[model samples]
Target: MSLVDLIARADERGLAASGLACLDRCVPLLGGDDEVLRPLWSSLADGGADGDAWGERLAKARAELDCADPSADTVPGFGPDPAPGSGSGAETETEAETEAAVSDEDRAAALARRMLATAPGDPGASALRAWADACSAAALQIHRLLDVAADGDGPLVAAERRRQVAVLELLAGRGAGGLRPALEVSTEGRRVLRAVVSRRARGRS
Candidate 1:
């Protein structure tokens, strides 16, 4: 199935794999200004966007899909273009052409870390900053958790660690909002880690 198809397969099924597939498709589709991915891409919740509230975020992403700027409040969803009811291969091709406009990314990850490309480090980068803070704390907590739980080799601990790493990756490359429940590598794993991080961060400050 196409990457989009994989994403829409079923929210509870293959969420991580679907996200990876979507990313794979994005490699060739990003960087340009087509604005086609605006609806689908924005809907993803990198990591910080908790699962409970993700649907609202997805809606905003889809609504603002036409906006090209990431900070502009648009994050696209992976929903079928022309909306499941377009009724024609030709329309799909047209949508493809429309999405094809954005072909190259000029961001830090895609480029050579030239600038703070994902989002500015300034306070205005609210989404990026919130997620960043969440992820950073999550990472440290998860690491400590792993070290303490190393001898246990418990599947639960392993699963939690995996989730933390995935969240970190999502924040690092795609910002905190790209990690949709649909894109989650470990489902609720990162969330548990996020709580641990919150307590630790509170203790520190």
Candidate 2:
């Protein structure tokens, strides 16, 4: 089944896992350690029924990611746009413009951070559905931005799409049992993203 079809029919647990897996794979962009979101995943494995546990772990993950403020729309230092300012001269204006422009990397990271920030505390059916859909889009966009190939749909994007579809398929077929393999898929993607982030940093240096 298509990802959209799968998501539309996913149960509450499947939806939560789908969204959390997307964010987990993009953790490198948020500067999160490998285990920062482990609690949240464990909560899911515990059946994801305790909304309180999910909320607590979600808050902790956000804190670990330095996104403690839920109201903040953009990640600090990675804003989608430049801060407004007046330049006194043409040269100053040009410099300001350069500083104000957001890089693809920054925008990608911002989207990842937003995914974390917007995760629902309640994990209801409606909320999880919206967050899952949004995360899928954001994760795909992040991969597209970081993909170095001239083609918009490069290997990174293609792999991400496959992983996403694999995740939903796993959940659809195996129910809660699928969380483990789904996480394995996400872990592979996380490693890929970490490598991409490292390579980009090295290139910049």
Candidate 3:
């Protein structure tokens, strides 16, 4: 089923997980460790997104990511290490590299913060629906921003859509156990994003 269809059928908890999982997968782009969002995942165990546990876990994630500042939308340093003998002029290159890193980090942090903001604990249908829609848009936007391909309408977006669908389907078919498979798919996407960053960095060099 399509992502839209899967989301429509998903309960409140499923919807939250779907969105959270997407953000969690992209943590790599923000220089976050793989297990950073694991606490949030644990809260979803009982098909619930409410109570102190969710809030505490969310706060921990924000702290761990050093994203405690809601206004912290800056992207940290990203891209490949500078190559030797590139002769791009070290001083100028350093300034350019700094700009690139900040830009990427700012954008990435903003996207992740937005995703976190959308998380609602056991929301009603209306709230859940709105959150789901936001998640879809955010997920697509996140992919677009991180994508190395210049074309706005490119294969990257298509692939992200497919992955979203696959994640939702896995949730539908396997319930709680689906989180593992869905996360695996997300890990693959993270690798792709990392590669894109490396490629862009190489091009700059």
Candidate 4:
């Protein structure tokens, strides 16, 4: 089934996992360490019996990532492009392009941070579904922005899509048992994103 269909059919746990997986992979952009989200994952594994656990863990995660205030950040929009001749000469144009690229990366990171910041503390099914859908979009956009190759979808984007699909499929077919393997898929994606982030940082140096 398509990723959309899978998400629509998913239960609360599946939706939570789906959204968390997306955010987890993008954690590199937030300067988060690998284990930062483990508490949330463990809460899901336990079926969220203790509702307070999820909320407390979420608060801790937010504090650690320093994304505690969602309202402080503005959601980005596709504003009009700069007018022609905004910069003159070839060197000026190159600098402009580089600045644009960095701006895109900054926007991408902001999107990822927004995903985390806006995640509901006591997520109901409706909230989880919305978050999952938004995370999917933000994660894909993050990969696309960071992808050095401007080719259609790019390898990074294509792999991210596949991983999202695989995660949902695993949850659909295996239930809670799928969380481990789904997490594994997310881990691989996280590594890829970290490398990309590191490469870009080195390039900027």
| Lowest-sum lDDT 10-residue window in model 2 | 74-83
lDDT agreement with native, every candidate: 0.35, 0.86, 0.70, 0.87
lDDT of 2 by residue, 65-91 (tens): 888776668543343443456435785
For lDDT, the strongest prediction is: 4
lDDT of 2 at 187: 95
- lDDT, residue 147, model 3: 63
Q: Pick the candidate with the highest TM-score.
A: 2
The TM-scores of all predictions, comma-separated, are 0.22, 0.87, 0.72, 0.86
Error of 2 at 127 (Å): 0.2
82 in model 1: Cα distance from truth in Å? 63
The true-structure Cα RMSD of candidate 4 reads 4.9
Clashes per candidate (backbone, < 3 Å) = 25, 0, 5, 0
Please report the TM-score between candidate 4 and the true structure: 0.86
Write one digit per residue (lDDT tens) for candidate 1, span 118-174.
Answer: 222222234433433333333333334333355554554555445544444444444
lDDT of 3 by residue, 1-205 (tens): 6677788898766776677767876776567777888777777775456657877787777777766654433334433455676556876578576767566446665666766655554456667667767767776777777665686847767788888888778877888888778778877876776677668667778
Q: List the candidate 4 regions with Cα displacement exceeding 4 Å.
A: 76-102
Q: lDDT at 36 for candidate 3?
A: 82
Off by over 4 Å in 2: 75-100
